[model samples]
Target: MRTITLCSGKGGVGKTLLATSLGRIIQRQEKCNVLLVDLDLSVRGLTLLAFQNKYELDRLPFSLTDYFYLEDEDQPALLHDLHKGLAQNNSNAEESQETTAQATAGPSPYERLDGLFILPSSTESERPDWTPLHHLELNETIDKLGKLYEFATSSLHVDYVIFDTQAGLGSLSLAATTLSDMNLIVLEEDDISWRTALNALMEISALNKRLQQKSHSYFLANKVSSSMLDTADKLKAFSFLPPIPFDAWVQKLFAHATTAVLEKDFEQSDFFKQVESRVWQELAVILGARQRTTGNGPRSSWWRG
Candidate 1:
């Protein structure tokens, strides 16, 4: 299984949004099993994004916290059980009263897709005691995280494991970087964001070089205001993925509980189409998805919501 981690040197650069959207796209278009992991220990962004209906309340018997704090003797058994559960727990929910938030039929676009599972961080109400994590040595904790994700990819048999990492240069982020097959460092079209992202890219690149690891890194510039002049020229040095414009509609969509797949007009929107094209070109190739061609067009069918 290939693992990709979405991280940022600084916060508020739209990491979680891109992770969810990309995961959804990959699952639908590639027809592969994906596990979306939320490694942002402090901020439960992925949890909230997947926290719409009551099905996910008891979807998984354990959270990431549970995995970390469990006794050593029990950890292996629990991990084994978690892996076993992966096959039984299909991410897709059939159309039913329990699955629907509104009076709609079929799975909601906001929910997880078929073969695309989410391992969300513990919510505020269900937050586990973090004292154990604090007591563990920093390096040990980082190694543990890396091992946990490795297990997800190896034992869970997922085709892709996407990590929504915490911002900044913390041990957690480093652990994720060390384990990822590819890293996407997200930034904004501002000086501060660019500076931090450059620093992060350097650090990640250097670490991989030192370790002799085969991980690749990419830059993603997000939320470029339409009024901002010469945005492309400014970000040229970074060789960033297509820059996502700062649209008020997109901001509002993320402000509430929503997913990009739920955007009914996604295929029609020029911005989303561009983003999708880049994903198919760069991310899909990195993940080793064979480019399929049909009589209609080169890319797959447009998203139908």
Candidate 2:
């Protein structure tokens, strides 16, 4: 499975919104098993956008925290079992819940979104005691998370796993970056946002080298106010970085609980046009997705997200 992470060095740049929207589009259009996992310890609310229903999974049975504490067995086995439990929980709920926050159906491998699944950070009420995640412990925990990601793709047959990373440069964000095959950064165009995002981009570049990882990542300039587009001519980053304008209609999708996917005129709005095309283009590069493009095009390689 290919893992894509959306991260920013700072918060409130609409990272979750972008991740959820991309998750929906990729799951529906690509016909791939998509798991939208939220690794934010502060607020694991990405599911609210899609799975508004109560995720009543007992906190004891499984959680990412458990894997962090129980350093007994090999990490792969522990995470594999946890993933299975989550899948079973969704599968059981499938019959009753016809429509999920994203797709109408239960939460199984075969649930509403054929090729999508989401493993949030923790369904538990309180955050796990991160005391155990010391320097060595943190490194090991990330190693396990990375292994879990590989398991999701190879053994479990998931097509894509998108991560809603914590809103900062921390251990969790580092873990997400380390495990990701491709990364995307969603940021605004304001001066402050750009400064913060530049720091994030440098971090992503350093991350790629540190892990000996190879992934094509990009930044999505979100809510591109007229000022940002005007600055594109000056800043090199803004030129190729896909810019998405503000759309009130798309904003409404997140305002309420579950969206009426069928009734929602996503096609009518221009929100999906530029952003969606760029997403597809980025996906193609990351996944080696075949496409007929103009020959002798510029070499495609990116270290920044």
Q: How big is the positional error of residue 16 in model 2, measured in Å on the Cα after superposition?
A: 1.6
Q: How close is every model to the real structure, measured as TM-score?
A: 0.76, 0.75
lDDT of 2 by residue, 228-296 (tens): 665652342432455677777777865664333322465455666655676556565546654537545
Tens digit per residue, CA lDDT, model 1, 1-305 = 67788998889998887887777677777788778887776776787777655565455555676676677787887665555444343343233343233233333222265666787666343545544233446567667887777665554457778889888856667677787877888988778888998788887777677767767777787777676625653553444555677667667656664655445554455446656776545566545665434323232211101
Can you tell me which runs of candidate 2 are displaced by over 4 Å?
55-61, 69-112, 125-138, 230-239, 258-269, 295-299, 302-305
Clashes in predicted model 1 = 0
